[model samples]
Target: MNILELRKKAVQLRKRTWELIYNHKNGHTGSDLSCTDILVALYYNVLNQTPETVGTLEADTYIQSKGHAVEIWYEVLADKGYIDRDDLEKGYSTFNSPYIGHPTTDVKGMEFHTGSLGHGLGLGVGVALAAKMNSLKKHTYVLMGDGEQAEGSIWEAAMAASNYNLDNLTAIIDHNDLQITGTTDSVMRSNPISNKYEAFGWNVIEVDGNDLAALIHVLTSENNTGKPRLIVANTVKGKGITVAENRADWHHKVPSQEEFEEGIRELDAQMEALNHE
Candidate 1:
């Protein structure tokens, strides 16, 4: 898809997220919104796996390190045909549901069950190393929250990825600036993200997290850079909703009926604009 089309799809996905969460009365609303564009770019442009071959070893892998945004991931999976939309809308985060609050490997396209904050990069590093050892051509992509970077384990994994020269690994930080408690700076400052990743010996790129064109360009260019890559995606906390943007309260807060309607309308307008462009 072209950049404009990708943006339209992202707006659609954001609309779906609001609908699903509002319908189910559950989800990490702000975090999910913050990561939607990056997710759209990956599933639509970068990642090589599909619902049909998600189980195959040759397919590329996507691991969500910041697992609270599982709602967005689940929605993307369903949109991509990895799972039925009915199952997603009905069973998400419920008892015996495959769509839990965090991603699980049992889900057709999920590479890991992550929600713990600091563990995803380590898992990604291991997957990248294993792929190198086995001579597999598959790439491993992991998404981490900016707040999650405070965890020491992420650095440990960062060091390992650089040491092993895992060029096939890409870690994108959803730099939404807000976590569950408050702004990331207030909770635990992790700024200078691009510089920090560079210090860790990885190639770092900074982009507007919501910009589909920039995301696709950076990701595609980084693929053959011969070094582990980190894209620090600067994003708003509640990306698609003007009223909720960068508000910490919306991190997991469900919108009221009125707010939900407004959110969907806002996304629809954005989609319409993209379509016209």
Candidate 2:
């Protein structure tokens, strides 16, 4: 898809996720919105894996470390035909639903069961290293949260990734600056994040996480160059909705009826603007 089409698709996904979360009465709203464009760019443009190629050695791997934001991931998977729309929209968050608040292997296209912070990067390192040892020319991607950077395990994984020269691994951080309780700076201060990764022997690049064109260019154009890469995707929490933007409470707060209606209106306007463009 072109930049405009990807932008439009982002709005659609945002709208769909908002509806699902509101109806189901649960979700990490801010976390989900903050990472929507990142997921869209990966699933719709960068990823080589499909529903058919999932779990194969020849395909790309995507693990969402910030699993609380799985609502957006679920919507993206459905859009890509990896999961049935009916099952996701209707069965999500219900009794015994595989569609819980986090990523689970039972869901098709999910490479790992993730939710525990700081683990995704380590898992990604292992996958990328295995692929290297197997001599497979495939890539692995891990999407993590800024708050998750506080976990000491992330640094441990960073050191290992560098030691093994897992250049095929690309880790993206949703640098939205907020977690469930409040601002990450107030919590653990993961900024200078790029510098940390660079010192750990990983190549680091920072970009506006919400911009599809920028994301596509960086993700596709960058050469691996014999080191793992980290993209600090600086993003706004509760992106695309005025009321929810940057509010930490929205990290898991279900929207009120009024907030839901307003959110739909904003997303619809975004789509309409894209049509004119």
Q: Candidate 2: how many backbone clashes?
A: 0
True-vs-predicted CA distance for residue 252, candidate 1, Å: 0.5
96-127 in candidate 1: lDDT tens per residue?
A: 98877788888888877788889999998988
TM-score of each: 0.96, 0.99
Per-candidate alpha-carbon RMSD to the true structure: 1.2, 0.8
Residue 228 in candidate 2, Cα distance off native in Å: 0.3
- Single out the weakest 10-residue window by summed lDDT for candidate 2: 221-230
Q: For candidate 2, write residues 169-234 as lDDT tens digits.
A: 999999999887889989888777899999999889999999999999999976557999999999
**How does model 2 fare in lDDT?**
0.93
Q: In model 2, where do residues sit more than 4 Å from their true spots?
A: none
**Cα error of candidate 1 at position 143, Å:** 0.3
